[model samples]
Target: MTLAHRPGGHSAARRRALLGRATLTWPGLAYITAFMAVPVLLVLGFSFLTRGRFGGVVAPFTLDNFARAVEPVYLRIYAVSLLIAAATTALALLIGYPTAYAISRLPARWRTVALICIVLPFWTSFLIRTYAWILLLNSEGPVNRTLLEIGLIGAPLRLLYTPGAVIVGLLYAYLPLVVLPVYAALDRLDPLLREAAMNLGASRARTFWDITLPLTIPGALIGAIFVFVPSLGNFVVPELLGGGKTVMIGNLIRDQFLEARDWPFGAVLALMMIAVLLGAFAGQAAIARRINGTARA
Candidate 1:
């Protein structure tokens, strides 16, 4: 009789625990559904629906926009955007990892201050930062004048409104994003493990390559996503810095909506961006699972 009563009591406790978890998760679920899920579904629905003679979407359904999106020219634009985004991610990683590691190794009292300094620029307007780059890279700007005075080049070199300038702006804007996650990972790492590796005669480089890098990959991957996504979808950088010559997918989308008055085409571009983001999410999940499996081992 006691055993029978014990099983029922345990079942009741399990139900209560499950209910508590559900209650805690409901708010977040609702928030995501309201903001993220709804917006995505709306875009998807709009992509299939026909566009009015003007820029607006009509109620009727069609696949004409998506069909057009697969054309060779649009496909090339997508490819270029992917390539640029990948390059930006790589550059951010190259700079951010070392910076994060350095910060993580700093005195405990200084770590917070260092991180705040890194993040301080983000609190300001993103457009303002990009505009500042425009001013610096302009033909008669301080950078050009200094280079000319130093005889580094014969002329201003037309540095502004070019692909290289766009890339430079991207790196400057997104460097902090990559650093923060990497710093978090390094901060959470067990210093004793690194010391143990050193004591076992592993060189510093070997320890970092074998132990530190593998452990820190999840955070690095997150940083890559953070940099890649925005760079891929960035309009301001291309507009202000690219001088309308370097046409990216983001610019194409803007033209479709504003100039061409093609809302359906814009929706299709939006869907493509969503697909890329989903792919990034899947990659992150895979990396995280691999990290967890290695931890278990």
Candidate 2:
């Protein structure tokens, strides 16, 4: 019998194909379930439980942890962290958009070189990079010495261990994230669209403002989320740069767990962070879809 003429042949082949795909994916699925999924489930459970007298979680599940996280003190940290993240996102976009546009205008070979330079920082350890920033921004660092020599300031400015330093560090850390996505968007953009706009009497600036920027909004949003999400929860940059003065939600969560031994409250904070991350992602998706639909229309 021919393949088409054979009853149940299509179903049998489909089952085999599905089974083959499942076999291929099982290892990754098992790993994710075991490591990520199970841990998240545990955290969720812990969030609802009570903290033990010493450390660890206990029974007598209650909703008070979530309530405690909403107090004025914790809320202030959340606000500060959000504002810092917002500033970082804005600065990254302002800096990265121009940078990505410039790189997009470069020769293809040069574009690759520029991108490599943007991402080269990742090769080093993150902690090591943060420490490097501390060395550069410290009171006796080159930045202050240069300013002093140039008569900009008589004394060395306190650059390190300040909120501004933290912002700068976050910006330095996440700028590459912004650049790569924006560059990808600009790379995918058709040259013809810009040409057509110019052909129709649009100025170069007008062409970009009208056509280029709108189309690249999705990428910019993606980059913004990329920077904002991590910046919001980043304790390291703030710790190294802000010197414990600027307490972010991340630091608060860490202290609750390690110092206060309040695992339940820490889990609540973690859950809140996760929820915010999800919201950011969902909003990005919704905005991207809306922009895409608008572009198509």
Candidate 3:
């Protein structure tokens, strides 16, 4: 028999294929183990330990940090963080859905232009972008100057240091994330389905509600999760815009680690946040699997 018909040949081919996949994947696996897994394990270990005398942990390990984290004061911070994250996710979805749908409807050449506009903000530094918002929202900035010129308001208003400003910053920062995913979903949709609906006497709105919306729900959910998780843990926008007035879980964790010199408690907070992060990732995976399953069906 030819080599192709031999069992050893087939086994050898399988081995070569496995070896090639291993070669391709090992670098990524090694990076994750070194950076992500190892750091997470270190943080987990530190969470149960006692705080150090000066800055580092010298452990007669204890659960006090975890207990401290459940206190009412920190719970309020958690609540505020959740509220801000939810608001950001809602606003991103509200804006991103239509934006993505519009992009999907564009001519192929123009679609690229539209997407470039959507993500153009990313070309600049995030810190720089945040600072630019500060300048625009400041009392003497162009936003207020335009309002003054138009007689819209008597004053600049306290736009710089508030929860609303934080939300605005977050929405601006993460809006592209929502738009990209929703656009993918909309782009993948078969036009024939909408055509068939219209042919069957359904209106455009009805077709979108009945067909397009349901199909793209996975993408929307993925985008929402993407925006929500980061917004929840974000500290920078709240600090710069909220001006120390809006305190979230991220700020709390930062303070515990850097300011208060309580690494154990900080680790506890990080651990809690990591739990939420892991849950978000799991949900994202489930949505992806559902999308794949739907595509297969």
Candidate 4:
């Protein structure tokens, strides 16, 4: 008998397929709903609430917290955070692109080794790695000692506890993130394209610029976004390297909740960060679509 003419048999098969699909997807859906969606909703709801005199959130709703976020002091923090994040992303790109290119050109066996070296830092605790930087950049650290011995400086230059130090920390942390994506893009690239460009009388540099670089822009953008987003809200790097002098949005949010005892204000700041991140993600998506469209054309 045909499946349609088999009465309840068709219905039973359809139900089984539906059940199997639900079984595969439901766990992931539930996890996201419980963790990501719920927390985001809680933060959004809290942002409109009043802060209690002691610590917790209060009942009556208000916009005062958001208003306070726009005040000069907080705005200055936001500006500094943006500057730091931008600098970090730029530096990571500058350093990572060449490294990734070189790695991609290596023999297949060595390519794995190079990539492992790039990612090795991630195996350790991030906090521990930051502490390692403190040891390396401190006044009496090896960097300063080497410079002094070489007569490059009369004394230990103040490398640690500065905005520059914060940038260094960020670059150290996120450079690998930029390298991996760029390498993936470069490695996936067809070598025949470059050969064809050279056959057409294009110089090596010209081929790279016209043929390879344009194609890899999306990957570079992905890496830049990856580095920039985390660096914006990074409290640990600024706190450890910038030494409280460099207060970013992340630090400000922490202080609002813990020190100032203003949960609502903290929620507002957190929500603002989320808004900025969402805007970045949207921009990335649009740019990716344009790049893909260009590729298809």
Candidate 5:
């Protein structure tokens, strides 16, 4: 007679609750296990194992791959990759923060369109986009032609196939990544906080520093991670845009896997990439926690 005992109603409700939780978590867990965690484990295993003839892993385990990765030649490439990634992150932040701020201040009617424009490039194939830069920056390309026509120089500037060009390509490809999170953060910020600061006799700059900036740091950090991690491991941009002259860790990994036919070494490089990405994510999480703690206090 009681609802709890009527026709398995309570059992059905419990089953539904369990099913709801399973439905919510099953897709994400499956994805992580299949694509992220398993692949990462495979790489880690290969890093510690010996490479067999022609790129397969051998039965023996060894640390030689990791040891070899730290040799001067490879270390130099890693250092350069880190430098370029850092530079790209910095440039993306500088360019994206202002754009995000302007976008955040736009009327609501225009904001969605602005965001679409920011993210629209992501819809295109990344390789195709990089190749487009190839056409634009080539010696006989439109950019060079315009510069020559304007009498800026006697010849086309060597705009492609340099480290600077690689950085430029990276910044172009990743700027939207930095902008989107920043816009999300800034849009969530309360404008009245700025007004409150002003009411307390704070200057616009001071209000920004003390209120707006802190509130948006999380978003900026998110954007920086988005730019930094991928830029660190990018091979296509440096290959196509840099014309195979600029070699980063991603290129190194590719060479090991394909050209050198050394799976163990490639696995080591892959592990290092994962480590760097994880470190970035951990750093971001720490900063976010600190920010939230400060807000709570």
Candidate 6:
């Protein structure tokens, strides 16, 4: 009998294909379930339970943890974290877009070199990088000494252990994240589109605003999320740069868990952070879909 003439042949093939696909995906699904989904569910469960007298979680559940997370002290920390994160994202966008644009416009042979320069810092440990910043931004560091010797200021400026230092640290660390995505977007863009716009009497600036910028919004948004999400929960940057003065939600969460031994409250803060990240991702996805639809139209 021919393959088509066999009654159950097509159905049997479809089943095999489905099974193959499932087999391929099982490892990833199992990893997520075992690590990500399970931990998140555990944190959610812990958020409701009472804190033990010493460290761990207790049996009886209560809403007090969530309620305490919204109090004035924690609210202030949230506000500060939001402001810092926003500033970091904005600065990264402004700086990274131009940088990515420049890199994208480079010769094909030179592009790889430029990209390597941008991402070279990632080869080192993040904690080591943060410590390097601490060295550069300290009162007696090279930055202040250079400025003093240059006669720009009377005395060495206190650059480290301040809010501005925290922002600087965040910007330095996350700038590469912004650049990579924007570069990818600009690199993939067809050169002919820009040429056609220019041929139609659109000025370079006008073409950028009308054609190039609009097309790269998705990439910019991706970079923004990359910087913003991590900046929001970053304790190390603020701790090392701000010198314990600037307390972000991340520091607060850490303190609750370790210092205070309040597991429930810490879990509550963690859940709040996760919720913010989820909301940001959802909003980005919705905006991306709208942009894609408009582009298609």
Candidate 1 lDDT over 160-274, as tens digits, reads: 9888888888888889999999999998889998999999999999999988999999999999989998888887788889897777888988887789888778989989888
Backbone collisions counted per model: 0, 0, 0, 0, 0, 0
Q: Candidate 2: which stretches are off by over 4 Å? A: 1-12
RMSD of each predicted structure:
3.8, 1.9, 2.7, 2.1, 2.1, 2.2
Q: What is the alpha-carbon lDDT of model 2 when measured against the actual structure?
A: 0.91
**Which whole-number lDDT from 0 to 100 does residue 216 have in model 4?**
84
TM-score of every prediction relative to native: 0.88, 0.95, 0.90, 0.93, 0.93, 0.92
Colliding residue pairs in candidate 2: none
Which residue pairs of candidate 6 clash? Answer: none
Of candidate 2, the 10-residue stretch with the lowest lDDT total is 1-10
Residues 212-256, model 4: lDDT tens digits: 897887788888988998898889999999998999988988888
Q: Write the per-residue lDDT of candidate 6 for residues 185-220, one digit (tens) a residue.
A: 898788898999999999999999988998888889
CA shift of 280, model 2, Å: 1.0
lDDT of 1 at 193: 84
Candidate 5 local lDDT, 1-297, one digit each (tens) = 365878898888889899999999999999999998898898889888887776678978898998999999988998999999999999999999999999988999899999999999977788888888889999999999999999998989999998988999899889999999999999888788888899999998998899888888989999999998899889998898888888998899888888888988999998888888888888888998998798668
Model 4 residue 33 CA deviation in Å: 0.8
Weakest 10 consecutive residues, lDDT, candidate 4? 1-10
Candidate 5 overall lDDT versus native: 0.90
Q: Supply the TM-score for candidate 1.
A: 0.88
In model 2, how large is the Cα lDDT of residue 130? 89
lDDT at 85, model 4: 93
lDDT of 3 by residue, 240-264 (tens): 9889899988888889888999988
Q: Candidate 4 regions off by >4 Å?
A: 1-10
